[model samples]
Target: MKVLFLQPPMGGWVTWGKHIAINVNHAQLAANLREWYPNIDVHVLDCRALEIDENTMIKILKDIDPNLVYMGDALQTTGVAAIHPRYKRAADLIKSNLPNTKICVGGFFYGANAQNILEETESFDFIIAGETEATMPELAKELSKGDPNISVVKGLTYRDNGSVKMTDYRPLIKNLDELPLPAYDLFPMDKYVGFNYVKKYVETYHSRGCPNGCLFCVGWSNYDKRGKNDWTKYRIRSGKRVVDELEILVKKYGAKFVCIMDEDFNVYRPRVEEFIDEMNKRNLNVPFFFMGRAPYHLRDKDLLKPLREIGFVCGLIGLEAVDEETLKKLHKNVQVDQVAEVVNLFRENNIMSVTTWMVGYPDDDESKIKNRFERIDAIDPDMMALQIMTPLPGIPMYDELKPFIQEWNLEKWDFQHAVINTKHLSREDLGRLAAWANREFYSKPGRIQRILYDKNYHPLCKLIARCYVETADKHAQAAMKNEVFV
Candidate 1:
């Protein structure tokens, strides 16, 4: 009946924005299991948050001695398929130590390709495919009983008779309000921070799935069914429910700042209105962050005033690419002009616009890469995430990029590392350009002064600026050292 959610030693490049985070997915899975199956003892050992070493983790594992261990990270931990290698190694270590404890893996990346994960690793006993809130507790109930007739469980993947077996895809949870609140008491809430600086901060999700089916995004591919439904579906909690979590995080946990690490927010206009109204009603105007599309902000211009009025300090809405042709190739339904328009809009409202841009497309050369930088720089976002175009293992562009992929290490699947070469550039070339762009952008003249003295910049936004620069330096340093470059 004892279950452990184990996040192995994760830091360095594995961290998001060089800050440690509570594995929200781990917390949610354990919470749901405890709520539905109270007898099942759930414990979380988040090494990322605890900042433990291998020796310390092994010692703690022995102390806990859990019967079942879960390995998965949500959006916050940058828990894409890139972390698979680390989690797989940790699973092997657990098996060698316990010799009898069961292990399961799921998340935005591994779960989408569950059958392959089980086929490749003997260490993992189950894969909770798709949205795990419902499947996890059901599997836990069976595991607690000592006899797992796993075939009966839907949205699960396992090994059967020496072959990989996958149950039918579970239906999406349309009503997110039905789920119980996360078991925050189980987490070391005090240890988490945002932008690597905000002590009184938390990262959470208000919705699941993004309708924007960008080809290079593994997170979006997880929700897509790849059929007539195309974009498939997205499920979001009511505005009241989202505000309820914010209230608890602020009033109860004393959180001064929060990050809505949803894959994308502001998809549905009504839900956003509800969220704003509830926050106003509760008077919980603690500064916060969220991610959404450039077009959504433009479409919902009316909401910007209220959004700023209620402590919306920063947001991560990616520009993706600048040129129209590149945008079309990347499947971003945005005009070349909307990129700057949205950034200007957020700036006018005093919301720090944290946007993203990608380099290393199939036809990119030094000229194209430089053009990307010149374009995004002109957009004047408060923070820009300059990423090497990483085409991850199961994303829509993976197969097409497979032939060009020079690196097979799952650990390097993060966008920070270039895995595939374009027609005009090598992997090393892409990394070097990324390194150059990162240095050039962050070191722009008077950027620090603007962040430090600009009245428009929110205090938390300044923290985000500092965190972004530090993290960018780490990435740029790695590329310069050839640690990540070819």
Candidate 2:
């Protein structure tokens, strides 16, 4: 049987960056399917990398004429997380164009509501939930057998008569080392670009599931289903295994920098330290970045400094809300004082930091919101992102704010839109505040001066710093006319 894995066209936000990257997980899924059914012809169409449009996609599907279609909605070449709406459109078009083809959907969106997704997109015949490495192979074997009882398939959801049938969720993968390295070669490697902050980068996941139960985050709730393991529960691959993949990218694919895309890069302190040790011992000079919590950084200040010296450029710090009360509401374990200390630690080590802040949280009042903004101005990082609080489905924030949720469109959930009506701030007010934060933080000349004065500034640091100022100026000018806030 022939199978085609389709990654739909991503929105402009993902395309805005110079280099468009492929979803590592999608490549892994393709590789897993090939490993399972070696006889089955497998083809991958990454729309973002190839820059394929509706007509191009239609022609490709028609030409392949596969028996089954596996569409990935997790991460498009676009940087955004949620499945693009175009996936549904592509599935619908394929179903109409090729009646013999069976369509299936998987990835984060489907994981959230597998049954509804399959039903809503009438084109899809089945839905696979969680860790496609194992599930996809099992699903294929069952389908190949012409099994009519798909409901019996574990981690599957499908339509039965008028109702949706969902099987039990699969357990998380324990031995990540057992899995094959992601099929990066299957993608157009040259098309992928690192963000402005780094010269060249490849994204790799160290583990699945995060223990941090930050309310505004969907990742937190995602792991909550796995019983007592804290929402931040993490299972990491061996350092040798991680380094093995990096070596392949470096030796064959020419990856100079790696962006460790874990929810928190330092989840297991010993493992992280070991990983850093392995990289150093092997003389792996590849620079890397990661997502880290302020508290973690503070605790591991000594350990992190060495990593920085060994090409760890910068990372994203989740300073969700500047005010303590707002942070408490968001379930972010760190305090405001901790944020200041973390920033100082990064500065002391000469590592650049990109801090993320959320405004207009559900429990926030005008005073609290103002205080948050003031804190943002006071504790400004080298780079910052200010977004309105969005209550995504399956998260505690969503449950708490569902009554006040004014919109449900997936596209609008992109931090730019105010989907929920806050008690203290109106939608318009939130938009303005976001615009104000962008202008205030980026508009100041002193922001650049601080980076320049820092003792540990590298040559590449100057290049990234210039890019930040230019991007900020562009945003400020654009937002001034109330044209670019959304």
Candidate 3:
């Protein structure tokens, strides 16, 4: 039996610094299959990394003709949301061309809404509800026997007797160290693109789950039927384990820069300290970046200089909103003061900070929106990502705003477009304001000049700052023109 993990062509997004990156989750699943089910032939077909087109992708899929085709994304909500549309397109092509081949879909996108998605389209044969590492190998093993009982496979969803069916939820891995590292060798490591210099710039998942129950976020299995443990607790890999992977990425793969793609990289300050210690012992001097809550910076304020000394160049702050009332309603659990402090602290230490916010809440008005702009400006983060508040399926925000949701098209739920209008503002008004807010920040000559000439910034960091500024300019223009906000 042969299994292929396909990252379809015409797929992927430039959401991160406007650069398309390799999905490490793909390598993780492929590695687990190779390690646990060595009898089966495993292959990866990443049209995204190879820059293949639809015609060529069709040709290659037919050539490989794997018995099982898998479609999944990075094990995060935002990552899957950004790429789910492409996966649907790819699965349609696969189903049409290779009608006999079995198709399986995983990741937060398909798994959370497995029943609806399965009912809507016949493209995906099975969906994994939670994690795929343990489930995928077992699934492949069953299929190889030629008489498979998919119902018995935990965390799996499939069609049954003309109705959609889902099995029991899969339990979260208690210890992350038990899993194999991502199979980077199986991917086109050289072709992976990043916002930084064209060296091997890759990202990794050192941990899973976040306990912070922000209503607007899909973090911590909030939208899936994941086990109870996942809903309340967070799990992490050991400092030693994290360093081991980083060492491999930097030395073995020649990675000059890396991004820690964890939702809460600073969930535990001690883990970061241990990571720094191991990084030094291994002499792994690769510069890296991470994004997380603002309070974590206060916890590690003393370690800022040491982190910088050992190649920590930047950290993205999840500043969802600067208004207290809005923050309370969203359960962001972050204070505006903390955001201002974190931005200033990172600036003093020469580490760049990028803060993100969501506009177009149901009660928002022009005055409130303008107030947010002033608040963000006061904090003065190196960059800002002011996106419209897009309500997605299976989340509290989505359910709450269902009546007000004007755009039912799933593809536009990528967080870049204005889908819902506020009580006092129209969707058109939100788009225009979003455009103005984006231009208002990036158009600042002082900001761009300060970053371009900052002596402490890494050359690649400077380049990334410029990239986002330009991307924001283009996106803003698209919004004003009533085109796709991406």
Report the number of the highest-lDDT candidate.
Answer: 1
lDDT, candidate 1, equals 0.77
Better of 1 and 2 by TM-score: 1
Ranking of models by TM-score: 3, 1, 2
* Model 3 agreement with the true structure over 111-139: per-residue lDDT tens digits: 56666777877788887777777887888
Candidates, ranked, lDDT? 1, 3, 2
**Pick by TM-score: 2 or 3, better one:** 3
Query: How many residue pairs of model 2 clash at the backbone?
Result: 7
lDDT of each: 0.77, 0.67, 0.76
Instruction: Please give the distance, in angstroms, between residue 368's alpha carbon in candidate 2 and its true position after superposition.
Output: 2.5
lDDT of 2 by residue, 1-486 (tens): 777778776553311234355676677777777776777677888786688987888799889887778875333223233353666777878878898888777665455556656667777877776555667656765667654557666777776786777777777667878877887777777666654544445778767766676777755433313334434456667877888888887778888667777777776678778878888887887777778888888878788678887777777788887667767866788887887777777777888877878876766666776677788677767877666676655566667778777756566555655566788776666656666777778767878876766667655555556555555543333323433211
TM-score of each: 0.95, 0.89, 0.95
Give me the displacement of residue 419 in model 2, in angstroms: 2.0
Give me the runs in candidate 1 sitting further than 4 Å from their true place: 12-16, 76-79, 221-231, 482-486
Residue pairs that clash (backbone atoms under 3 angstroms), model 3? none
